[model samples]
Target: MFPQSICAVSMEKTSDQVFQIIALIVLVITSQSQNSCTAKTFTNLTTDESSLLRLKAEITLDPDLTITRNWSSRSSVCSWIGVTCSTRHHRITALNISNMGIYGSIPPQLGNLSFLASLDLSSNYFSGTLPRELSSLRRLKYISLWSNGMKGEIPSWLSLLPKLEYLSLRNNTFIGSIPISISNLTNLYHLDFSNNSLQGKIPQELVGMQRLQHLSIQYNYLSGSIPPALFNISTLRVLAFSVNMLSGRIPNDLCANLPSIERLHLRGNRLSGQIPSNLSRCSQLELLSLRSNSFSGQIPAAVGDLRALQFLDLSDNHLSVYFPTGTLPLSIFDISSLQVLSLQRTNLYGNIPREVGNLTMLISLDLGYNNFTGMKTKGYVIRAFV
Candidate 1:
């Protein structure tokens, strides 16, 4: 009953309106889908999150534990379990869970954390290969995953983290050679790969880590001469390369250049040659161990100048040296410090200086397997405390 023109105009209007409404519905669905994806990714990070949190909650009562209450109200993860976060939005900066006795594999989802500074999961029972995805944590600074049962080769991709400073993967089952790319970690300060199944020469590339302060690669299957480049690290303070298959003379200038060195352990190896007298140049030296080696020489008298020395072990070798002269520096007698000393199996025939009695601080003194008697016996009384 209506005119054709009127009907046509109404139909056109209706079609345009329907198109607009459909476009609006599509836009809404897209926005919601994106938001849901983000939520699901974060919410279901681990299907076992409840168990993880319940385990960590016990940390609040431990004498060794402390946590910020402010984050406790956030989501379980956003909450402060092992987390350290930024001041503004509380993004995690560190996640130290050392000695927690937490069992199971490390969650690869941890790689999603972009702001983490440190991740310490030491002394746990974690097993399986270390997740290589960890390389995605570009902001990571320190990582300690020692004392576990983790297997497989060390993740070579970790060298990509620009801010990494400290890395310890000691006392694990990791096998294979140290990655040459480790040299790329220029900002590294402390590195320990000790007590693993790592074999082959210490990477010469590691010599490039100039900022490195402490390095320990002991108790592995590492063979070959100690890298001469190691001695060149000017900032090095503590160096432990013991209990390996390492042979050959320790780099000559090793201790000569490390003026700041406080402790040096080169024991339990096939290392040969006289103990470097130049080692006395380590004015800050406190501990020195050269046991179980093939060293044959006189104990350097310059060693007495190491007034800061607290512990010294040259036992289980063929060293021929007499005690330094004088009332063993009064510093050595101070009961407040200087506790242990061992010179066992050294071929020495001398009188025990009476000054040995002055070392009241000595707790364990080993002079067995030697040839000291007479005057040495008197000195032995004062110093036998070690």
Candidate 2:
């Protein structure tokens, strides 16, 4: 061609232009790839598939629930308020819709989320039987449907969940017997069916649940003899069977072997027989209630040995006995943790112990209604005691 120098200069310029074009193409491709990944990671959710969308729609119509519309399905669920997500992704793991005043039956479609662990639908106006479809969520661990107007028997399908640990169906209008299938929930730790219309014998198979720690079936229509197995479970720390129609002799060894017991309530039943002297073995006993039963016996002095005891109620029974005179055990007076002591309506005719003032933490002391007629004089004692 023309001149070697000019050709060389033009070649250099063309090379530079080609390099710039290739660099621009790479930049555009990289930007598009980043945007595509983001779009895929947080796919836009339609109103039909979004539980949050439906919740928001309902909350919008309610004057009481001032929910914000800022909630989006595209955002990480963990970042959303009142939602807990698993570590794997932004899938909702726990939904606490308590006291939301959202009036509607729980949508059966909620079973679509397999990662859900806890569902709290308490203190609302939700009506209708719990959907059987909820049993599809195999990962569910906790379920609370208390303080609602729900009816129907406890769903047997729910007992099939492998991971269910805590269940509360208290304060509902549910009727029928406590399903025997409840024994299948071996992993359950806390089971509360209180304040319902559930009636039937305490299933003996429930004793097989080794993990149960708290069992509250109070204020129900349950009848029959108190299952002996109920007293033998060592894992039980809180046992509330109050306001039921259970009867039988008070097991002498109820808390004798259970070293982990902290609270025991057997009030408002037809339980009879002597107070177990061996109950002092419940070294960890803090709150013990034996009120309003037909128990007729002498109060055991070993009761004063409960060093960890804080609240004791032996009222409304035919207990004809003294405080088992002698100096009250150091655990009773020196513990300084006793708060409530109600011995009213018992047959105690001894002088009121002046050492009762040693309970600085005593908040409520009801010693009236007993045969004792002595009036202890001290303004601090009455002021310190409720």
Candidate 3:
């Protein structure tokens, strides 16, 4: 029995010894796996499907039940409403669910749509700021969230997208300065952030956007001088900076580089100084509103040189330069395209020039509260005071 026990003891392994043997085997196997894996390939996920499904789940209200009833996991993702997929790659390229009256916050998972090019969630009740994760969409081009309840500073990441062309975030509660980095959108054409509570001086860097055409930052609480560089954007077609707290003299060379300008609205601001006499340089100008400003100078005869000038409003300003002894700015009558001319309270006093009859296209003429003894100016519907 003693000899048998000694042999058994010699052959037996302790629990610690067994555990070490198992661990060694596991280490060898794990080392082999590490060597074999050069890169991880994630699978079992349809990127577009997962991202959209997550977004649909966040809708607190859908006015038409468009998303709730139609966005089923059973259907192919391309068949879903507002989703458009590419024929070759079978990837979602556009998601325009605008004006749906749906209420929800944008899901960060939406950034997973690697092929998405256009995203339009405008005229909805979508609240909260834009998801930062949206910056991951390197292929995104168009983004519009107009008339939503979105609030917060405009994201700076918007400048990262190289191909972004159209962007409108107007009619929201966005407050703070217009980002200086917006100049980074070198390829952008149409951009509107109007009707927000944006403040601060207009960024001079906006001149960097050489391709910008229509830029509307009007109806905000923006303060300080209009950036002179903004006038240098020769590509600008519509530049509206009206109804703000902006206070400064307009640069004399305002119309020098602005060859493509059509509408120039700078009304309802605290602007002082003579209206730029170089206005004739804007050959394409159709609408000009310098009304409700503190401009104190005689009307520039250069304004008559605008062959395309249709609407001109110099109303509610101190525009009488000894006009009681002087005649009217008769040069305006030369504009055959003049449609609406409001010179209310401009302190002019003179007999209405018979050339006033030259405005055959004049539709709305408001000469109210100005010192004018007039001959009958005919063919205007909105009154011509004399």
Candidate 4:
């Protein structure tokens, strides 16, 4: 009986020892797994760092030595100039080297920055076509390559960036038609392709971009009438199609459609027809420039309703008459915010309204080449030339 009892006790002790050993093995395995995960997470940054180094090698001239001196392998790339990294994952997010006077073609290796968001290489001398590899950066939001010497057609692959908000390729030498594929960028708010040689009609597909706020395509060779659908983009704040070959009448309901418009620049075009009476609807208008167009007929009295008008340039047009014969519209002098008023070479025959003194903010008033007589000058420091 004693022997059987001892045997049972020995077996129970052995079972407890076996269970403890199994638990210890599991704890060690779990600890190693966690350590492995941490190591892998940190090592992933090496790929991003390598990609940046490759880009640095491609830059032949950094006049300020900004990138050459700062971008080094000895330190974390996040500390490098113009590089912004996220805190959580230590991934590069923004690269803003604008106005750095650097000269080099953008490297395709930049596409490897999968986490990059904003890239501003403006005011640089970078030349060559944008690499197709850039399409890999699906996370990009803002891209500015303005004032660069980059040649070739603006890449259609830019439309692939789904989250892009601001895109400015202005003052470059890009040619070819503005890509209709750009309509794919639904989130795009500001699109400036100005000062380029881009020809062809404004893409009608651009009306699909509901978020667009500023659309400036000025100084291009783009011809054809302004798309009426473009005026319907109620979110537009500045519509600058000036200095182009755009002709045809300004849409009659232009202001009614663009309730948010502040600056409407249709100057230096061959546009004709009467100034739309709906100009009164643009109560938010700050600048209205329709100079050097073929527009004829009496100036609309609704111009007086633009109380927020600061700069109005209707010079060099064929506006024949103003209301109340031989006198300027009384509302022209009533805009308290009027700063610059230019009615030069419009054959305006009238007496300068004495109420011009009411413009407290008036800085410049050019009524040159008009048939105005008996000009009574205001006491303010306005640069008036009759």
Please list the C-alpha lDDT of all candidates, in the order they appear. 0.74, 0.76, 0.85, 0.87
Query: Best lDDT goes to which candidate?
Result: 4
lDDT of 2 by residue, 230-334 (tens): 777789898888888888786787776578889888888888888887877998999888888888877776787788989888777887755545222334556
lDDT of 4 by residue, 1-386 (tens): 56998999999999999999999999999999999987544434676788788878888899989999999999999998999999987899899999999888888878878888999999999999999988988999999999999999989999999999999999999999999999999999999999999999998999999899999999989899998889899999999998989889878888877888999888988899999988999989999999888998877888999999989988889977744444567877788899998887787776667787888998887777676666444212334321
- Measured with C-alpha atoms, the lDDT of residue 159 in candidate 3 is 89
Q: Candidate 3 at 193: error in angstroms?
A: 1.1
**Model 4 CA deviation exceeding 4 Å by range:** 1-43, 322-325, 374-386
What is the lDDT, from 0 to 100, of the residue 115 in candidate 2?
70
**lDDT (Cα, tens digit) per residue for candidate 1, span 229-275:** 78888898889988988998876556667888888888888989887
Error of 3 at 47 (Å): 1.7
lDDT of 3 by residue, 203-310 (tens): 888889999899988899999998888888899999888899999898998989999999998888999999998999999999999888899978988988898998
**Judged by TM-score, which candidate is best?**
4
> RMSD (Cα, Å) of candidate 3?
6.3
Q: Is candidate 2 or candidate 4 better by lDDT?
A: 4
**lDDT score, residue 95, model 2?**
79
Worst 10 residues of 2 by lDDT: 377-386
| Per-residue lDDT of 268 in model 3 | 88
Candidate 3: count of backbone clashes, pairs at least 3 residues apart or interchain: 1
